[model samples]
Target chain A: MSAPVVELVGLTRTFPGPPPVHALDGVDLVVRAGEYVSVVGPSGSGKSTLLHVLGLLDRPTGGDYLLDGVPTSTTSERHRARLRGGRIGFVFQQFHLLPHRSVLDNVLLATLYSGVPRAERVDRARAALERVGLDHRVDAAPTTLSGGERQRVAVARAVVTGPSLLLADEPTGNLDSVSSAAVMDLFDELHASGLTLVVITHDPVVSARAQRRVRISDGLLAEL
Target chain B: MRRRAAPVALEDVLELAEAETPPPPPPPRRRRWWGRPWRRGDGFDLRDLLAEGVASVGARPGRLALTMLGTVLGIASLVVTVGLAQTAAGQVGRQFDAVAATQVVVRPGSVLTQSGEERATGRLPWDAEERVERLAGVEDAGALAAVDLGGAPVTAVPVNDPSAPAAVSPPVVAASPGLLDAVRGRVVTGRSFDAGHDARADRVVVLGARAAERLGVGRVDRQPTVFLGEVPYTVIGVVDGVQRRTDLLDAVLVPLGTARADLGLAAPEELQVRIEVGAGPLVARQAPVALDPGSDDAFDVEAPPERSRAREAVQADLNATFLALGAVALLVGGLGIANVTLLSVLERRGEIGLRRAVGATRRQVAGQFLVESVVLGLLGGVVGASLGVLVVVGVSVVQAWTPVLDLPTAFGSALLGGLIGLVAGAYPAVKAATVEPITALRGGV
Candidate 1:
């Protein structure tokens, strides 16, 4: 197998409270290059917390996370943010698209913080939109798009920076069956072309599409 | 074909991504001199910060206008108060220059006698007018004295009616030929007595406008004569429009030599000198000395209290009073901007969180909001400055006075608005910068 794009060793996340809550307990995982991995869990199963730690949005209390061979546990917050922008991409269930912006602008904004050159941002955004099969909707506003189309635009924004790892949290939880299949087909096409993807969901049908599946429950993970 | 096309596009994007990756940091030897590494190509630049700020501010027009109102009023009032103060000071100085600023009066020095009565210590020289006229800055000089005509009732008719309802008698004043010119009085009708009249002691009298009206002598062309005591004097002229020494408009004036001979006037009591404006102090000092060269204490002089100093004092007083009021208004305006900007921060918390998530640093986020507030303040300042100029000009037009305003003051006031906005927006910008990215994620989820 190629070098691992993500390595988690003894990662633990604890939230401070009167009685502290452990969101991730001794989680260990590895996502190799060009791999499509699915994390399956129910509500409050620490799936989101694990995703947060993997995306460098939240720091783990103990142990190390190596993203693209760089140890991220001891990096500064600014360095982590830079890594998050240039190397990692996130797709949330709600899409998180700015309604007032044009579809093309939504994708171009991802390049603003990812070190993309100003002259090439438009071309990169257009190429990313074409890859998502939404090239015709570049001039349309996000508010004018359907739920599936908006999700496609969000995916385009996520991939516009050409991130090393793409993280999706319930990407199809709000979509219809037809739209869910369409997005899954897009993911399969991405994985076929050597992109690393980690999709978190509770639906077995969605998890089954991935080459590797991991089940998470009550802050612990078991590979299936 | 589709599978091959996907991989080729992915290879292109991956190649670009690899090329764009930042180089590894230099090996640690000593601590880096700069606190933050220069991330020039990575994060936000000045252009991006400004564009984001402008876009955010332009998103809401109504709120922007409401926030700017306070700054506008504050800046407008400040400009108006300062402009009007300068204009009014100029107007007052001009009016003062016309009359009071150009006059100097010299009177005989007095002493207490052994019997406890005030007596003139020294008499004015007989050629007092000619003596003082030679002094520099003395435009015109005249000698004057009140003639004591021993119970003689001066009247228009020669009939000495004892029971004619006790008519009030007009007083007689002895004056040199230059008195009318010195006092800035104009001859309303007829002519004034000349030097020849004084040399010949011709007994020609000039009637003040009020005195002529009381004596019922309107036309001097017919050679009207008025009786001073028992001697008849021809009324040669009626003098009016006396700017200085307005009391001269209500007296009957006779030639100084004629008063000395016929009315037995002892000595001239006072000298009136009309100097050029702003020459009061110099003329006052020199006139007293010129009147009595041997005795410095022979005369008391009163000059218009230092014209420029008095004008500056008045201007300073006006500026202080109005500027304080304008500052208070400006402070209130700044507070208003702060209040509204804070509200905007609170309202846009989610948006701010989203920006933070999308790779904007805390400084970048703060900078965006700061730029927004500054733009608002600057706009208000420009509008406010224009409004203030208009107000000053309008008031000047209504009052028929010249409007005075400094260009830099107007320009600086607008810049002050931008500065106020910066100060006002600081706390709110900090608050925005502190918003966590997790808020955006949690909110979306």
Candidate 2:
């Protein structure tokens, strides 16, 4: 690879109180272009913490975070959010589509946040929904969709912006095996379509689908 | 299939966005709707703000609708009350101005007996006119003598027709030319009093419009004859109408001298006086005493200037009353707005937090609330203004009154309504702006 898409050096996060609690300690990491990588750990091992920092949802307590080449550690909240909305697409363990919105509208919301023109959002949303085989379910409620379909809708929302990085915080965490395979298969298809995918899960079966696996323990990351 | 890789990270997007940013910056923020219109900024654009705000709020339609209702009603109430009060004030000013301004009346008689016997005389002597005319403070003074229709047995017979209905004129001194000036009449016929005519108590007369028209007496120089107490009188000029019902315009303006002789009203029924220029105090005291129209009272002194002053005082009092009523309406509007804002703040705790998390400053949040409040006030003002105008115009059309739509009054009412909304919205909007997002999102009120 010409250069890594993301590089984090000596990243540490500490929340202040009577005695400071360290959420992440002295971490160095690199994510190459279009690579499907999984970070898996038990609770409190900082897998989600690392994802938050990488996704621009939060700044590291101490670190140099270089994206492509420029720095994000010192950027304003506005810039950080702009970057997050434009570049990084996040999929939560829970399908977090706003409850009141239709599935198509939910997909359009991502486009709206990314600053698409008002009239273009619907067509873009439709095209995104079709990519996940949900074109016919355009006006359906997010709540009405089954576990697998809802997860797919969430995935559709994530990739709608054509974001380079797709962070999946346990894509099939809430699904049964049958539904899990459906979600995993969709991720495989997206990976083939040139999206850099990061799946965070403690499931060994989930980890097995990734091209490379990284284990996090006690705020430390190890390649497996 | 080849394993694809290339994470679109933050740096890549920022680089792209920096390059894509328009050079001239989208028409320089396109005129901010709130405060400073079209001032240059380092990217704090109201258009962008509105777009983001609408999207964020639109995400929750039920809550937004409920909040909008509260604001709209608050603003509307403000506008309507203010507009109505102003319309009423204008109506009062126009009608009252036509009649008098700060006016007072001075009737002459005290309460007296009705039996034909000359009881305790409730009278101002007809000759007392000289005394009133000479008063140093009095300006624009004139004396008028009246003849009671009840006491007279007069008949009118037009020369050409010879048998028309008797003109209902009692007989009056049409006095000096000053009498015409005193009651605001103009001689549209031959001429008014010359010295000789007034001094000799000439038997020449002027007919009021109705009397002249009825008697077929349109001539200016040809001497028309009318009988009064069996004596014949010559006609002189004509005027429009009687100013007071008790005093007849339809009556003749016989020379003041001739009227005294012809009517035998040496002891007059009432006296008319107008105070001197700027003699407000004298005239002011004169009117209430006069023009009372009741027999129990002494002779009523009808002082024009005083009556006008009293009318102005009455109008002022009415204006104050309307202002107080308007104030009460404003209070109600304010309370309603406050109640709504408080409820909105409480209901929208989570949403406020979300906007803050999305990068809105405290000022921006508070400002959004204020803008919403102002919009409510303006909307209400628009609706209320339309209703008020309709009422004013409708009244004018149906009742034959003129409408005076004063801009200051209209704007004043609207501004007051806006003030009510702003005051009511302030604390709640601030409280909403300052709410911490983490806890609000975690649990809502």
Candidate 3:
């Protein structure tokens, strides 16, 4: 009976040029509560553009994006950012952890711009690290961690805010097969605990782990 | 039985309901994750920004030190320059205070008292020096008059030779007995004419150093004699270091009685008085009264400045010149900050992208850079001011002067450094804020 966690209709994004390339054209998608969906596509198939629009990092030229039952097209950039920090979380392929901070500080960084209270931020960060099996590495720097452990730290940072939706862009692209499997298993654990997930990857093995899969080619989408 | 059952049922039913209730669905938006209300604009804490500023500044110690050098030089030079100007001014003031301030000159002036006819003027009495010497602060007093020795030129040799270049014509002056002490003159060789010589109307003279030279007289041991228009006078002494009436150094001095009896000298024209420090005004007002009780208005007294206005004037001029130089140096320091900040923004594109992606607004990004620059400037200002004060004290110690520095000027320079940093960082912070997140994520241009 609750509204869908994410809804996009007629989404269009264009890059201004002499030829005027359309990165996304009339894409429609719906993700309900607690669902795990994987968007699979080739290198130039507009997946990044779609992710950018969904993450509120870039606005679509024409479309409707409803996040948590609230239309985000008309919101100010500040309000959109608020929604991004409050309702959604991102895990990038590069892990993007600040090198100067400790693993624990890296996780706590998510609460810096989320309005989290000062007293409880460290405790919440610690609990999130424990969830991702990184409690032992709390004081260690991100540079000291292996690829798999670093990816796990990134996941902890993403879910530290208890967001309604988690978006992972190429989560296992830079990992070995074993590390990839470990990261996927961690995502499975997060999903089993009633968290919504959307993974964007070109790897078939990564897509196969999701409950449902969608494919995109040349800015158009098709259910698989 | 029914009443007892009802009372038992109330407690048991409450306990059963408490156990059956499912914990309320994880409280939504208002209490997201942290279980507290989310207030708008509370995302970034000032403390965090300050911490971030510290971390960024601490990252490259060498670069921070190098950037601070400009401001250090700017502030240090400013303090030293101002301090030295004041010290040098004080040094010049002391010299003036010794001679100009301690000596007072009184001369006769003609006054028209609203009458059509102009009165001749109050002549300095023959005993003017004795009368003025009675005043409290008068250290010594003397009088001098020009003798009208009819048109004949003075010469050391009475017999003129045709080959002589020209006849020397030094004027002759009638001086009182106390002229030596009042004028602070030191007789290099022979003794000066005393009261005994003046009482007997002796034809004695004291040759000034220059006059003695002009007359080919070097030593008073030979009792050199020079002729005043064929009236032979004995040179009793040769005096040097006569500060006031330096023109008298080139003239011959004769006793007042000798000039009066031989050259028809009527009365003294000028009176000179030497007083203690801080007594010029008092002596100036009392000298005329002592000389002629009721005719005080007829004498004009020349006194040095009451306060060291000349020193202040010199200091103000020096301050204006040096402060301009300091401003230029400070401006250069500001530009150095701007240059470093811009380069930092270019180098930290990845960090900027990450922060922007993590919901840091443009203003927040700009604020971080601004705070970093201000911290850099403040550090430089504080260190520079301390070092400047040390340099001033050191120079003062070496020069044997008391160090002078305005505390407010020192503190204002420190704050000005911060202001310079703020202004300098403005453009760079804006440039950093305008960086596109996606482009910056690509690791710069």
Best by DockQ: 1
What DockQ, between 0 and 1, does each candidate earn?
Answer: 0.19, 0.06, 0.18
Candidate 2 residue runs with Cα over 4 Å from true position = A100-102, A113-120, A140-150, A170-179, B1-73, B90-98, B101-174, B177-199, B203-445
Instruction: Write model 2 residue lDDT over B417-443, tens digit each, in one string.
Output: 566667877887788777764445434
Q: Clashing residue pairs, candidate 1?
A: none
TM-score of the second chain in candidate 3:
0.69
Sort by TM-score, best first: what order? 1, 3, 2
Q: Kindly give the stretch of ten consecutive residues in candidate 1 chain B with the minimal lDDT sum.
A: B29-38
TM-score of each: 0.79, 0.59, 0.76
lDDT of 3: 0.83
In terms of TM-score, which candidate is stronger, 1 or 2? 1
Fraction of the true interface contacts (Cα pairs closer than 8 Å across chains) found in each model: 0.25, 0.03, 0.22
Instruction: State the lDDT of candidate 1 residue by residue for A88-192, as single tens digits.
Output: 887878888876668998887778877887777788788888878899999997889888888898888887777888899899988998888988887877777
lDDT of 3 at B75: 80
Task: Give the per-prediction TM-score of chain B.
Answer: 0.74, 0.53, 0.69
Q: Which candidate is the best by lDDT?
A: 1
TM-score of chain A in every predicted structure: 0.98, 0.96, 0.98
For candidate 1, give the lDDT of residue A138.
Answer: 94
State residue B196's C-alpha deviation in candidate 3, in Å: 11
- Candidate 1 lDDT for residue B63: 77
